[model samples]
Target: MDFFTAQDNARRKTGRLVVLLVLAVLALIVVTTLAIAVAFYLMGDQSTAQADLSAQGMLSALSIELVFGVAIGVLAVVVLGGLFKRSQLGRGGRAVAEALGGREINLNTRDADERRILNVVEEMAIASGTPVPSVYVLEEESINAFAAGYQTNDAVIGITRGTIRNLNRDELQGVVAHEFSHILHGDMRLNMRLISILHGILIIGFLGGMLLRSMRFRRVGGGGKRDNSGAIILALGAALMVIGYAGTFFGNLIKSAVSRQREYLADASAVQFTRNPEGIGNALVKIGSHTLGSHLQATQAAEFSHLFFGQGVRQGFSQIMATHPPVKERIKRVMPDWDGRFEATWPKQPDETDAPDSLDSDERSAAGHRFGSGAEPGTQAAVLTAASAQTAIGSMGQPDQRHLAQARATLGALPEQIRTAAHEPYAARALMHALLLSEDKATRKHQLEVLQQAAQPDVYQALMDYGPDVLKLDVALRLPLIELALPALRSLSMPQAQHFRICMERLIEADGQVSLFEWTLYQLLLNNLSEQGSGPSSLKLNDLQRECQMLLTVLAAAGQDDPDEISAALNAAESELPFSLTAIEDISDMRALSLAVERLRRLKPLHKPALLLAMARCIEHSGRILPAEAELFRAMSDILDCPMPPLLSEEA
Candidate 1:
């Protein structure tokens, strides 16, 4: 899928949803005003035995001012309810998961099933070049999963217990891939908005129920007058309840319209990502065969029904209000020639003996073969031809099987200890610290001294313990390793995350000068630790000419050491742009480069592909993507919200 196009489409859908909500609110206001006016007329006119409850009579009974007052009150309640829910979800995916009683799965989990699912998620994240999202497991028995976030930076994957126990690895990968599509397509933000806005509409119903319940405890013992007052209260409460439920019915229709098609797209995306139709196709079949059939047992399941891989809640009175298409139909789309049967059982799984954490010698040998063991890591030429560069750029936000295989091999290539460390919060921080340790003896010692002073005693000890293995890591694997540690690093307390960031900055500066790799690592780590918000992609390439120049200047400098060669790279990059460019005299001014990137990130969606092409041209000027250059390029692309797959040699 074209990631930017999908994002723009999702934005348009959000606009349409807002319009529908306004219409729903207007309908509610009119209905509520009429309900109140009828009640008032009957109570005030003692001759109510013959009172007209028709629209004309009600309109006459209620003054324009009274109607306006009721409309304002209804509008206020809906808006406030929505705002309150939105504010509650401001923490993003984590809050939603917690509300569903989802426990954040420990990355270092020893349970085989948990470990298996985590592996799939990590591989997908690495393949797509996004940071590993925090995974949460719900206690539910239904076969359901969901991806949630305002943006990829804060994204999370949630799975029901039945999902892990029921599906095998490929099926699980397919399900995970489907959720990743949601994340890449900018659907999560839209889903979150849907939840909050729908909550507002549903709150009117809740208020009506509350009003009805309160009447039971109300004292109505002052005689006939009290009896009339009670009757009016009863009438108003009943009317509000009916109106509230009517609003709910309309809200479901709105959600169904907005969500159903996205579900189909996600299913197709899963197939495209894995290149194995049976993976997701069979998964749908399994959901169909199962008794629960992807139905969630959580009380709030209906609230988030639209976010699930399958319909998470019971169907509405009409199929028109179902958030996902029927299971058999979904299966047919994935597996066209099917006989329409869902097997309740699959082949039994082999008992696990070796821990996934362990890699035997043969496995290591195979991984080394895939990545080239003898050659230096980042020195491999990436994007050997123009077509290859374009292919890589086009693959952003949609990684295929080859990338998945490469991610698996990359994980296998790492030392077992480092992989283990990458999963633990404290060890992950240490690994990041060790990644910054300099190669030179004096510089390395100074970096250690900086960490020793600023970091916790335990974190410092872990770094010292594994510093050697980390330093010996292949250059290409370094960034991926950092990506693996991200989820763990994210688990760090706010104070700890702050301290970690400060320590990293101190370490990078400890060497007195920042290498290209160091700059890239610092930027990548810091960016992942914070939340990223996307803006309107209204600015064209020309609008941010200076920012574009600064960005290309830094990238060109990183790729080519010679001043003349840097200019050559810039010239090559300029050929791809609408305007000429100039290289900055102070290429080492990392601060300026950072600012330029922050600005460049705001380029219009369609304009980004061209800028990315220009970046590829600039780096390709050296005729090869050096390890440092590749790191910097990927880091910059990630900050731009474009996920660049891992760069590798042509032969690989």
Candidate 2:
């Protein structure tokens, strides 16, 4: 499913979860009321207790003062439990990862494993056409990983040390692909919501534990005033403990039911992404044979079990409460021709490096290729033909092994120094400035003056130094170049990031106009800032029609040359769209247009696909799409959570 459908499924699951939670709360209320009624009846006079035990008497007891008090307590516990958990997670996925003891990997790391994973993630990011995500390494001896974030750009990928130490390069690539699929399919957002809600549900148990502690501390033996009160307190604490533990059981059941189907989908996505079933299938096989078996040793593992690359913790309720499918079943799904037996894999030696290993004759004969070599080789030319452009547009949700190889090739094709600079935080900042430099001498001169006054001296120098080579870069490569800087840019301190943002704004405004490329770069950069949190959004599609009109107006105007061509494109795009009649005939004011696109970014996940489809129709009005126009659409799609893979010109 596309992001919209996946998001809608998540929405529906939220509703189902609410229904289940309601049933659980009702069950808790009934249990609490019964416990309270029995406590009062048994502790009261014998004659009165016998009378109260009758059926009608029991019904009457439920409406008594004590039952009402018990019912209120249950309501309070469930409400407070949910509210507290939501509050803890209000900061979003980064908070969730940190809570699980994930240490964010440095952008410039010396460790080979760390550097290898970073390179894999970067290539995946460029291939998938989104900003590189912040990566975290959990210091646990478990073969598992997870992706988390509020949206695509802010997403972070986390892996355990065990995975890095044990798996070969291809196995690591397969695991990372699985996580990237989660990022692309809107699963991360859904999973974050699941974590928050499950935590809320589990808090009832935590409160019960606190109450049990109070009971343990109290002295209830003496026939003193305090002793009598202690007896009642003990009963209440015992009741909460039972109910709270029950809530946790119910929450896991819900998590298991919702997460299992998605795991199968992600497994398929990984194979589809790498075009090598053996990579992921072998990884799973390794997990089965290795002692770890995707089992996490971290204290926080059990709580985030559903988010792992495999089952992090074994479940007691068999398949009913298992968050993932069994290992052999999952492996078989990916590699239909797999041998039923799993061979044990010895962990790599501590001294051994992760350099590419020699493949066996059979493995080598199966596919004689490398990561970005699936495609034959597209000419390193500037033009976009109709066949290639259309294929690229339609390849949004489906990226094959060829796409993976092409992605690696695309990065290789970029200038070596630029690619190297993209990896470092400081040079990355300069890379951004260099990308914004204009080809026109006067415009370039004017931008330099503004950069000198507003930008940091080192940043200005880096831009000036890289200017000529940057100018020679392909239009298709520029976005990916900007994307390459995301991880480093994310490493900026909040204050530093704010300063950077201000400087970029000054540079854009200094040009006295906003070009489409510049506006796209700024908006994309903003989205890539994890602090922004996808900005505030409205759910109603109709409310944002003016913003939609503004977006289409700009796209329509810039995409075509003649007035008739612009009008025809707009009309074609509008034919099915029930948008506002108030459309901009002249889309010249760059700042105003930038604001319009910003507003459009707030369109709900479901609302975005229609807008994108409409815009695509508008762009294709000439019966051909330029490479620049395709890039613009792809960028727009990426921001909206619809990932479009790079169009293959030849192959790789």
Candidate 3:
């Protein structure tokens, strides 16, 4: 789905959610009212005494009870809403991906399978005009894949080892396209919201379970209460808990209904995207016939069933509250002639004794060959032709197989070196340096050498020309380059990776300020890298400190005229740095850097250049420029490349 459709769907879901919430509130109000009436009716003697009491006293007593009941009911709703908001379903989905020990595979890696997966995802992203999501591989034998994230920017796609081993390129593409459909249509967010809301509705039931266990323990210890009032209270709590659980049950039913429909949509979208129903249909058939059959044995599988390419969790409750459509029914939709029985004649496991000789040999040999090479020339040509053919055959306006093939070819053409370098820490740094250098032949040559040495020739050239190309063309080309390059960069070592990130920050602050596009790109790069590095070590802020120091220097230079202003700017900028600056040495005096720059901008806007120059000086204080630090300087120079500075005379 496109942005508008996704937005409309979200608005519609929000409206429906609001209506449901309102109904829940009304239901709570009605239930509370009835309970209060019942309570008053049970107080027969007290009611009579109250009637006989002074009018004011009776009024006060009734008022207090009514207030308490209303307050409790209102509080319940508020608490439930808050619970919904804080529900970790989305986070849980991410956690599952992380627990699977999935890492960002380098598209340029020597591993052909990993490269193929990367290529397909990138192709799809480019074709769809969306940012390529980070891809991870789970080590499990289950033939399962899931898409998870609260937003497109945060989304991740994970596939299992079984899937990698079992499915061919075409089949894998179909599975990936299916997950991308979910991301595109905003289904992941809705699913997360549903998890949260349902959690809220069932909070009381969880509490009830705890309470019952505690009561059981008390009884065993001979300390359990047996008074009539206590029994009544327990019974009341149990009843409310049951009722609350019913709410959860119904909520899940609703989620199931919604999810099932989306599954159909995704299946349709996948077929459309690849323009090959057989590819996806065959994948489904394989899942049914395979030993794993799409079932994930992971304890946390149920939480992510809705996000999976197929059902990952099996339970009696799942049938009633399943977030996926039945596999048979889905298969039937794609292949009407498909019987309910598993296709026993389908290809067997790779090493199975009974496996067909033709199938086993073909697969084994194909797996051994490099991606795009093993295929017959005619087949490749046909795929390329089909991929280029843009027939809108699916409900979601899927492109023809030719278009998909073309996409695949485009991805195949990306240089392996650049792809490898993208994951290196130095790639982004190198790209940043190249992008900021003066257009002089010597500088350009130096930049090229740096990029070549950094091992990203394709990307280096691309970065060098990106700005000019962007200026000449429109913003459309930018997404393709970024999408193509990002996954490769994700494969970098942590410290090396951090260097690129630091480079990005400096690039953003190159001119002593950031443009909207620059800021957006910076945030996007950060988020993309962050997802790849989900571990504690990956989350370390060491490189971020270095970047802040570089930024402070830029700010200091820009605000150098007035000592007080520079000092203040240094201090503020230091604090405003993206990571912890206090812990870093020599940055204690940089805290007011941002404030000083702001004050300077307010007092003397045109002096921005001077302030920026001062900041650069601060960054260069160590005398000889480190390669990484030099990149920062290059970035600043590039941002000021316009209007062309003249060569200075030696005498002057």
Q: TM-scores across all candidates?
A: 0.95, 0.88, 0.59
lDDT of 1 by residue, 539-587 (tens): 7889888888888888887765788999999999998899999887776
What C-alpha lDDT do the candidate models reach, one value each?
0.83, 0.74, 0.52
Please give, for residues 1-652, the per-residue lDDT of candidate 2 as tens digits: 6656665666677678778777777776777687666555545564675566676665554556776786788777777766776677665656667878999887667788887888788878777776788889988766888988777766889998888888777788889989888777767777777776667667767877888898767777566642455666676677668767777778778788778888988888888778878988888988888876788777877878888889989777668888888989999999899888867766565577576333245433332232222333221343444455456545555577766766766666666688777777667888888777777889889888987888778777788778777777666677788888887887778777887888888778777878877888887787677455546455566877777788887788777678777778788788647664345866677667767676776766677667876777778777766667877878777666566777665433
Q: Find the 10 residues in a row with the least total lDDT in model 3.
A: 641-650
Error of 1 at 414 (Å): 1.3
Q: How well does candidate 1 score on lDDT at residue 384?
A: 46
Candidate 1 Cα lDDT to native: 0.83
Model 2: ten consecutive residues of lowest lDDT: 370-379
The residue ranges of model 3 lying beyond 4 angstroms of the native Cα positions read: 1-3, 21-93, 99-116, 220-237, 315-320, 344-402, 432-438, 442-479, 487-502, 505-652
lDDT (C-alpha) at residue 239 in model 3: 50
Alpha carbon lDDT at 398, candidate 1 = 79
Q: Against the true structure, candidate 3 has what lDDT? A: 0.52
- Between candidates 2 and 3, the TM-score winner: 2
Tell me which of candidates 1 and 2 scores higher on lDDT: 1
The candidate that achieves the highest TM-score relative to the unseen native structure: 1
